[model samples]
Target: MDNLTHSLVGALIGQTGLKRKTGLNIPALIIGANLPDVDAACFFWLEGVEHLGFRRGITHGPPAWLLLPLVLAGMLWGFDRWQAKRGKRPEGRVPVHFGWLYLLGFIACLTHPALDWLNVYGIRLLEPFSSQWFYGDTLFIIDVWLWGLMGFATWWSLRQEKRGETWRKTGRQALALALVYIGVNGAISTYVASSAQAANPQATQVIASPLPVTSWDREVLLKVDYGYWAHVESSARQDLARPNKISVSPCRLSTATAGANSQLDAFLFWSRALIAERAEDGSVILRDARFYDPRARDRFSLALPDVECEPLAPPSP
Candidate 1:
């Protein structure tokens, strides 16, 4: 999920009466919600597709979940003391409770991974312990509907707060609605996956990727022996009658070249449904079936240069 969604979720959580727990409870919630994304810094040091292999890994795992909130609590405690020393602490602020801060931080931080897991981009829930990627295939990476739902609720809650009216109820309602929306989408994905599998028994894997604008629409990708099959499906239509075949001969690189190119290796490690094709220039163009876009050629693609490409035989039908 996008950082905006994460921040909004954190704020919503705070608005549900958790902000009253401590002086910096809101800040802790908001910051902790985005803390797992600190791994994004890998972009500065890692080039090309290397960040893909590193991101949503160790940071989104159990160890960081346990330790990050503690670190945040300590920082908030230090900041509170610093403010007191400078006599700049807010006069109306509630007493800062370290325990409450840690607990709130933990709660907010947990939402980050949970939301992240709902998209096809995938998350490493048990990273470091296991490098396996998990996908929810429920929602788009950035859903306008979610933005509207949570955004309105958060804004309305704050408005109610300013007017000294009941505010927590709005947040709670929004949270419930969001969960219901997620559940509906999950069911849709599950149905689509089952339909695809039933339609094509040869499919080894299937992904029901949610579209950006239409909540009911999904771009389904199925991995088969030859290559992949892709098509759009909606809640109104569950049939997989015809799908565009993305047929490409598998290009295998020599062990030496594969091990030497860090960028190629990283892309291979991250790509769940990988497809390799030999370009006209003899370079190997690597792509993932889930994110490949023909119009935008370079987005989710990596080209390996000066590598010997051997086209493998397609599996017998």
Candidate 2:
């Protein structure tokens, strides 16, 4: 999920009665929520698809989940002390406690991966221990509906806080509602994927990715023996059994274990539904069917000259 969503979730978590636990509660929540994204710094040194392989890895792993919050909490605790020493601390700021700060950070950090897992872009929950990727495929990376829900809830809770009314329950209710929304979406994803599998009995794998702006519409990708199949199916459509459009392409998986370049290697590594084609000049062109777009050709693709391309017949005049 995007940082905004992460930050909002952190804020909501803090407002759910955690903020009163520590002086730097909000900081711990918000910072911890986005802490796993420290892996994004890989982009600074790594180039292109290298980021893909490095990101959502170590930082999002089980060990990091346990330790990153401690790091963030320590920093926040130090910052507060430094502010006090410099006499720049706010007058209304409450005394900070290390334990409460760590707890808040931990709670916020935990939510980061959970929300990330809900999206199509996979997360490495067991990163250092295992490089396996897990996908919920329940929601889009950035769901406007979620933004609205979290935004409205945060705003309303703040208003209640200012009015000196009990606002903790408001935040709790918002979190409950958000959980319900995610649960419903998860069920829908499972239904859509099952329906697609039923339609294509030969499909080895069925990935049902939720489409933005639709509650029950999904772009289903199926890996068949021949190549791959893609279609857009909607549960709300009159014909739930039929997909809106079905596109099938025939190609073989690349024999090369590694890509010609880091970019291609990273893309291939991250791609779940990979498609490959033999180019005319004995090059291998690879694409991830998940991001397949005819109009925006080669957007999520890489060309490898070193990888052998299957022989093709010459065109007759």
Candidate 3:
């Protein structure tokens, strides 16, 4: 998920009565929510495509989940002490409790992975121990509706805070609403995916990803013995039995091995379901059916001429 979503969730967590537990708890929550993204720094040193292999890897794994929050808590604790010693601490600063801050940080950090797991982009939750990627296929990377829910709850909470009303209920309510939305979407994705797969008995694997902005729309990717295919259909349609539109040509794998390259490797590693189509010039074009956009077919695709693949036959006139 996006950093803004993570931060907003962190703030919501803080508003759930955790903020009053210790000084700098808000910072712990917000920072810990975004700390797993520290892996993004690899973009500077790692070239194009390499970052894909690296991002959402170790930092999001179990070890980091346990340790990163502690690191954040320690930093917040140290900063508070530093401020106190310099006599620069704010007069209203609450007595800092290191353990409570760590707890808050850990709780905030846990939310990061849970929310991230709600999106199509996969995360390696058990990294180091395992490199397997897990996908929720529940929501888009960014959902304005979710933003509205969290944002409105935040705004309402702040309003009540000014009036000195119990604002924790608002945060808790928002969290509950978000969970319900996620549960509904998960059910929809599951039903749609099953329907799509049942529609094509030949399809060996099916990945149904919910589309953004709409609740019942889904982008379905299918893996056949020969190649991959994709389509978008509405779960809200009365007739899910209606024929699907195959949005792109099936990318057929060649008899020869597609040559290995960094770009192709990274794309293959990240793609959940895809196909390899041979170009006329003996090159191979790998497209992830999951992200195939009719308007931008080339996007999320990798073309490798160096990788040797069986040459495609001349076009049938």
lDDT of each: 0.86, 0.80, 0.78
Tens-digit lDDT string for candidate 2 (164-225): 99999999999999999999999989988888788767677888888887855777776655
Tell me the TM-score of model 2. 0.91
Candidate maximizing lDDT: 1
Off by over 4 Å in 3: 237-259, 279-282, 294-299, 311-317
Could you arrange the candidates by lDDT from highest to lowest?
Answer: 1, 2, 3
**Against the hidden reference, what TM-scores do the models get?**
0.93, 0.91, 0.90
Tens-digit lDDT string for candidate 3 (215-309): 56877766544543545465566354443545443444543543455666677678776656667776677766666665645656777776655
Q: Tell me the TM-score of model 1.
A: 0.93
Q: Cα miss at 175, model 2 (Å)?
A: 0.3
Going through the candidates in the order shown, the clash numbers are: 0, 0, 1
The lDDT, on a scale of 0 to 1, for candidate 3 is 0.78
Task: Please list the Cα RMSD from the true structure of every candidate, rounded to 1 decimal place.
Answer: 2.2, 3.6, 3.1
lDDT of 2 at 273: 77
Note the residue pairs that clash in candidate 1. Answer: none
lDDT tens digits by residue: candidate 1, 209-298? 898889778887877665544554553565674555666656655667666778877887888878777888777888888877786457
